[model samples]
Target: MNNHLLRAALDAAERGWHVFPLRPGSKRPALHGEERCPRTGECASGHRKWEERATTDPARIHRAWCGRPFNVGIATGPSGLLVIDLDMPKNNSSSDTPSGVTTFKALCERAGQRVPTTRTVRTASGGMHLYFTAPPGVRLTNTAGTLAPLVDTRAGGGYVVAPGSITPGGSYVVVDDRPVAPLPGWLCEALQGPRRTPQPGPVPLATSASRYAAAALRNETQAVATAADGTRNHTLLRAARALGRLIATGDLTRAEVEEALSRAAAGNATQPERYYDDVIRRGLDWSIAHNSPRRPA
Candidate 1:
């Protein structure tokens, strides 16, 4: 790696961040060039490819190329770094929403922690990247899979929040001086343990039904005007409640609940004009299905 890039990575390490050097050949194809290898001009390794030189000597190549920016290296400061990639949801309706950032902030708030920087590493698409430095001796694997859904790891086209890896040219922004906190003990402990078989929790049937009914009412109101007092609405609402109860108690996964809701709404469609009703039905179904069982009154 370039001395500067390597130094930056080391600096990050000193600050308690984990560092991973980008492979010499990992850059996009267009960036490749016939530069002399750092090891040897005739050497097979770390030569000829722009990405290879960039990876091997990020600072030099970055200054020389001045075209494509460098990917950031993870800093292995006193604390290990937590790298996160922000991704856009596939659905166009919700595509513009800042769900990734919202989710990240929400989780951090819930866990009583904060990210280290607001500087975002922009993706090829217009998504933001955030980074956090964990306390000393903290391990990333401790929360790997559990936190997987919340952030992209860049292993499969997603970008990781690292140094030199994020440059301003590709719509990337690197925020600095943000506060970061240690991961919560409960979350760390839970993540460290083996995945446990999901269990059904005791949920009150009536409460589940009520929550489902409310969710259905909300969906119907959003999709259609006032709901007519009728058997169809009542039946749909009942199904929603049942699904909600299953969801709240961990009896059904989110995917299973969504599928059930889709099926339920499909059966309830009365007219082509009310196609949106199907969407509402599905949403309500999911809402109810995921409702947690109520505690004893």
Candidate 2:
């Protein structure tokens, strides 16, 4: 057994990340298969999958890596991690294929936000993984293309091969040593989505500026709710853009507008909430930028 592999496993465990062994030079788990389970040890109760068997126990780490130079795999869900995968396109020969890094930067620009700086890993295949701690009380699942093309996230029910793992392609290595950052609130909002709850009923209001804005919101919310299947995202964007004016002028808060639009769009949603979220966020950002408050004339 390679001492380096053992050390790597120990290092990950010390950081409080639950880890399991991967087959040497591969991403697949090295743990026993249920079909061939001896029905002993950890599986005595039942066959625990690799995720369940993952541990931060030093003794377990040493014992597991003693027989072979197994690669390390981090169970992101158990570790409270959300890793954003920024990938290089497989067919790099095509100019049209954008790298994950590029698309994610464009997404940040669209949201009028900066790309977060955090601990990062360079994958064996030359991709980047930005590590973040998931917010408390929010359990997110693995996502594919929820952010942008060639980008994915690993959270609950997904795992990431730890740095020091090697494969035929190359070795995973840490590029940034910074501590993992908390998942951004905007991102959490995008992935977790608006809480599913009963919609509020109509209430009478005075004919004021806020009332007009509220009426517009109600009308556009209805438009989005009744949008045709093929036009849901488009309708969501338009509605958000219209409501953003109220958000900018203090007639409404961005939070309320977001909640309103998200709730309205949820009924007609065909794509993942993240996709609709991206649409609404983009529209609101555009409106805010173009309709910034002016100084007294």
Query: TM-scores of all models?
Result: 0.35, 0.68
- For candidate 1, write residues 1-297 as lDDT tens digits: 355444554444455443344433242333324553355553455454321222333344345334332344443232344445655555654555555656666666776776435435555445565554444554444232255344543221122434444333343344554654443554445345653322222222233345554454345323222223354455555555655555556554445444444444443445452553455466556666466555699
Alpha carbon RMSD to native, model 2:
12.1
TM-score of 2: 0.68
Q: Residue by residue across 127-231, what tens digits does model 2's lDDT show?
A: 999999999998799998988988999999899999998999999999999999999999888887655544434433333446688888789888887787687
Range of the 10 consecutive residues with the lowest summed lDDT in candidate 1: 197-206
Off by over 4 Å in 1: 1-70, 75-79, 90-98, 108-124, 135-139, 142-145, 148-150, 153-169, 179-187, 190-297
lDDT of each: 0.45, 0.87
Could you tell me the lDDT of residue 92 within candidate 1? 59
Cα displacement (angstroms), candidate 2, residue 118, comes to 0.5
Give residue 158's error in model 2 in angstroms: 0.8
